[model samples]
Target: MTPVSLWNRSFVLWLVGSAQSRFAAALASIALSFLVLHQTGRAGQMAVTLACALIPNLVMPLAGAWVDRIGLKRPLIGANVVRGLLQLTVGGLALLGQQTGQDVPLWVINGAAFLTGLSSSVASPAAGAALPALVAPADLPRANGMMGSLAETMGLLGTFSGGFLVAAFSPAVAILLDGLSFLLMATLLLGVTLPNRPEGQPTSSSLWQDLRAGLRLMRRSWVLTVMPPLVLLVNAAIGPVLVVTPKLMETLGVGPRGYGLFLAMEGAGMLLIGVLFASLGSRLPLRACTLLGFLLSGVAQACMWLWPTYVPLLAASLVFGLGIGLINTPLGTLLQQGVPAAYLGRVFAVLSAVGAVGMPLTLLLVSPLVDRWPLSLWFGLNAVGLALGGAVWGALMRIEPHIPALAEERSIEQPQPRR
Candidate 1:
C-alpha cells in the first residue's frame, strides 16, 4: 500500500474538526458554570450540575465497545451533532429564563448536562481510534502530537475567552457559539471516510462479553496495563498542584496576575514541547525523551517545594509543562500505534475510565490535606511520585527497545477471543 501523506485532506479535516469540538466543549463548560450559578446562586447546586456532566465516564467501558461496533466514521459525526443541538437547547433555555425573570429548572439543565457528557465521552475515544486509519504508521507520532497540541491550545483559548464572552454578551451567547462550533465540527468531519474494519478480528456477542473482552485485551498487553496506572498516579499528583497554587502564589507574593502569568508560562512550555514532538519526536528516542520529561517534571515540582520564589517557580512551571507534553504525546502515540485497530476504542476508553477513578479520589484525599498541612509538603509529594513514575517507565523502556513492537508481538501471541 502506498503511504498516505500525513498532511492529506482527510487528516487535516479531522484535526480541525477535533479542535473545534474540544474548543466547543471548553466553552460549554464555562458557559454552563455561569448559567448554573446565575440561576441558582447555590454552590451545592452548581456542584451537582458539574457532577452530572462527569457521570457518563463511569460507563466508558461500555461506550468504547459501542464505538468499536459502530465504527468511527458515523459515531464521530453523530456525537458532534448531538452535542451541538444539546448545547443550543441549553443556551436557549438559559436565554429564555433570563428574559422571563425565571430560572430554568435545575433538573432540566442537569439532564441536558448528562446527555451532553454521554455523547462527549464517545467522541473523544473515537477520535483516538480513528487516527491511525487516517494517516500512515510512521506519521502516527506527529499526528498524535499535533492533535494533542491543538486540543491544549483550544482548551486554553476557550477557558480564557469564555469568561470574556459571558461578560461582554451573555452566557447564552457564549453557549450558542459553542453549539455552532460543534455543528461546524460535524461539517468538517463529514468529509472524513474511515477504512472498513479488518476481517477476522475478534468481537463479542453481547455488551457484557464485549466489556470483558476489552478488559481481557488490556490485561494481555503490558504497555496497556502499565500506562493507565501511571496515568492515574500522575493525575493524582497534579490534583494537589491545582489546590496548592493559590497558597504558593500568596507565599511568593505574586498575586492573582502573577498566578495567571505562571499558568501561561506553563502553557507556553506545553505548546513549545508539543511542536517539538510533532517535528522531532519520531526521530528521537522515545524512552529517553519520556524519561527526561518525567525527570524534569518531578524536579520542577521539587524546585517549587524547596524554593517557592517568583522566578524559580515560574521557571519550574515552564519545565513542568514541557514534561507534561513529553509524557502525554509519546504515551498517546504509543497507544495509538500499539493497540489493534479493532480494540483501540475499548482500550482508550478503559484507560480513561481508570484514570477518571483516581481524579476524584485524589481530590478527596488532597483537598483536606491542603488545609491541614503546609503547601510544600503536597508539592514535594507530587514531585516524588512523578519522579518515581519516571524511574519505572525508564526501567520498562530499557527492557524493550521498541515498546510498540513489543505490544504488537504480545498481542499477536495471545489467542483471539471467541465471537
Candidate 2:
C-alpha cells in the first residue's frame, strides 16, 4: 500500500499563494517607510502614515465576525483583490505625479495604506480559518510549520531587499511589485476548492451573535485568556530590545554586521525548528512543547542578563527563535483543532488585535526608558516575566480541565465533501 501524503494539491496551492502574499507584504512594509521618509523627511509625518495603517486594526474583530458569517473563500479572495487594487492605485498615482512634475497628495497615499490595512484585517483571519478545510486534522501542524517557515523567510527577504530596491529603483516599482503579488495570489486561490460546513449545520447567523459567541469562547477558555496576556508581555519586551541591542553591540565592538548576523541566526533557527515540526511534530505533545518553548525563551533572555556578550547573545537569538516556533505552532494547532469552523475567524481576529495593540504599546512604554535606564535592567525584567509566564501557563495546563471546545478534535478528522 502507498503511504498517504499531506502535500495535496489544495494544500500546496494554498501554501504557495499565501507565501507570495506574505512576501509582497514584507516588501510593501519596507517601501512604505522609505516612501514616507523620502517624501516628507519628517518623523512626525511618517508617524501619521504609520498610524493610518495601524488604525484599521480596531476593525479586526468586526471583520472576523463578518468573515465567519460569509465564510472564508470569498472573503480571502476579495481581500487580496481589493488590497492589490489599492496598492496599484497608489503606485500608479505616484508614478503619474512624478512624470507630470506634481507630487501625489499625502492624503492619497495615507488613504490607500489605510484601505489596504482594512482589507488585510479581514483576509488574515479568513486565511487562518480556511486552513483546516484544506488539510486533514493530523496534518495541521506540518502545514502550519511549512506556512510559518515560508512567511519568515519571505519577510526576511523583504526586509533585506527593501532598502536596496528603493535605492536601485523607484518606490513606485516596489509598490507595483507588491500589488502584483497580491493579484497573483488571488488568482491562485481562486482555483482552490475547500470543504464547507457539513449538512445540518445552521446557515450563517447575525454578526452580533457571532461576535458574542466568539467572545464567549474566549471567556470560557483558560488557554485563550492566558495567550493574550502572555503574547502582550513578550511582544512588549521587543521594544526595549530594539533600543538597547544596538548599544550593547557597540560595546562589544561590533557594528551593524553583528546585528544583521544576529537577526539572520534568529531567522535560521525559526526556519530550522519549523522544518522539524513539519515532520516530527505529530508525536510531540502540545502542552510539553508549549511549556518547553516558554522556558527556553525565558532562559535565553536570562542568558543575556547572566552573561552579556556577542557570541552568547547570538546563541540566545537562536534559542529565542526556536522557542517562538514551538510556542506559536502548537498553540495554532490547538486552536485549529478546538474551535468550530464558524468561530475560528473571530478568534484569530481577536488574537491579531491583541498583538497589534500590545506591540505599539510596548514601544510607547519602553522608548522613554531606554535613555534613562541601563540595558541590563530591561533584559533582567523581561527574563523574570517570561519565566513566570511560563510557570503560570504550565500550572494552568495541569489544573484546568480539558476544554469542551477542544473535544472537537475528532470532528476535524471527519471527512467532508469538497465544495
336: Cα error in model 1, Å: 1.8
List per-candidate RMSD values in Å: 4.7, 6.2
The alpha-carbon deviation from the true structure for residue 177 of candidate 1, after best TM-score superposition, in angstroms, is: 2.4
lDDT of 1 by residue, 1-419 (tens): 21378888888888888787666666665567657755654434554565566557777878887887768877788988998898898889888877887777888888987898789788867877888888898888887778877876876676556655665666787788888998998888878867555333465578676666767666655566677888778766776566466446656765334555576566667777777878775886666777889998998999988987789888998899888877877877877767777778888888886776665466555544665677777779889889888977977775555633323323544664321
Error of 2 at 199 (Å): 6.0
* Model 2 per-residue lDDT at 263: 57
Question: What lDDT tens digits, residue by residue, belong to model 2 across residues 232-328?
Answer: 6666655456446645655686643455456556666677767877777578688788888888878888888777888998899889878877788
Q: Which residue pairs show backbone clashes in model 2?
A: none
For all predicted structures, in order, the TM-scores are: 0.80, 0.78
Off by over 4 Å in 2: 1-5, 37-51, 92-109, 196-205, 239-264, 298-317, 361-388, 405-419
Top candidate on TM-score is 1
Candidate 1's displacement at residue 190, Å, is 1.3
